[model samples]
Target: MYVSLNRNTSKWVVKKFEENHNHVLHLPEHSHLLKSHRMVSEAQAINIDIAADIGLSLKASHDLLSAQAGGKECLGFTREDQKNYLRTRRQRSLKFGESGALLGYFRNQAAQNPYFYYAVQLDKEDMITNIFWADHEMITDYALFGDSISFDTTFRTNKEYRPFALFAGFNHFRMTCIFGAALLYDETVESFEWLFKTFLHAMSGKKPITKGKRMQDNGTLIEPLNQTTEHLLSPKYSRSIIRID
Candidate 1:
């Protein structure tokens, strides 16, 4: 199932940082990053059913995105088989080629499991849209296929973007997104949210961090129900009004 979002309807969706300006650092090359997260770290198929799970319609999704990005989705909610590879991912969890082995981790997995096809397509927006095949047997043909990635951009020549990271964790497994945040000095939630949602995946850990402001004007004087990220990864570090879904 494909969900399409047009301009100014649903207020939840945010473009993947790299999809727009590169916010979350989600890939293996930058896996060394200690703070952020990404989704497409490696080539994989996009789970489009995500929208259905989230109670979204193709039109509703299109509207949400169009509103969030303030643009029109030319190809709204369309499902087509286009090959895309995964891009960004988490820092601590990523495992690279074992080296010296004729068969690799991806190969073995492809040989065994059929849930995640090796050959997949990721849009410039970092969303998976296609796969080599929908089921197991057909995908085996691509398990050992040479990886091909398309890193697109000419706008970088201008100083409008910088690299950033967006991350989230589930159970014990963390996945980063590729095509992440802008590599710049000052950070913005717009960029962060983008990278955050790519690997945002399915059900998550906890509530999203909210705006830096408190509930009361003299709120600082009173005990608070929530906090921020200071010495730890708590709620206090968040600067936005509330976390974007």
Candidate 2:
């Protein structure tokens, strides 16, 4: 197909058209796989957001949507499309900067729940270096099942590659429960010190009786935990134990 501009009418007109094709046409069943036909509709976008909020992976979310739509061929969008959509949404959400957006979100949560606690650590340049947050439910859970808590920093965020730490324990039902979470700039003793202190403050200074850490190199983390214990513990709980696994 070709088009020409008609100066007299200031209009573009199709100048040439060919009935013969250069390649075989796509099958009707595969039409949805074409770029022109693939799209993430508004409803699908909402479903994707809900799925993400529930911690669904991109592939899982896409597969779920495909199942709902009867089959992958009827889903109208590919997993890559879903990934691009979510990526774009995250980029747009951080329009004001990631730190600012994070602070805003924390503030909003705190507003809704007065028991919500969050602390941000800044470097010498006043840039956010570490962040910790725990909601009211988490605080309550900690008060109940925090006697033996585990801390792990092996997980990392996909985009930032920052250490994503979790303060977790088990409920009476033996199900895993989260007490708090943090995003650390580094795995340094200073970062861990700040995170542990902030976590204790959020849980009303109730130090875990036994704190377990999962790390291959426990030397760096042990120092911080010991320092935190000495600084934050009362004489009555001075015998708190630290375990490494």
Q: What TM value does model 2 have?
A: 0.51
The runs of at least 3 residues in candidate 1 whose Cα sits more than 4 Å from the true structure, single-residue gaps closed, are 1-121, 124-191, 204-206, 209-243
Candidate 1 global CA lDDT score: 0.29
lDDT of 2 by residue, 34-83 (tens): 99999999999999999987778788899999999999999999999998
Error of 2 at 47 (Å): 39
- Cα lDDT tens digits, model 1, 1-245, are 23446568754454443335447645654452323332222121233234334646446654554464344332222222111111221110112221112125446765777453333333465433222212243222222220211111112212212222222222213222121112221133333333323322311222233223222111222222334311112122442222223
Measured over all alpha carbons after superposition, the RMSD of each candidate to the real structure, in angstroms, is 24.2, 13.0
Best by TM-score: 2
CA lDDT of every candidate? 0.29, 0.74
For model 2, give the 10-residue run with minimal summed lDDT. 230-239
Error of 1 at 31 (Å): 45
Which portions of model 2 miss their true places by more than 4 Å? 1-97, 211-221, 224-245
TM-score, every prediction? 0.18, 0.51
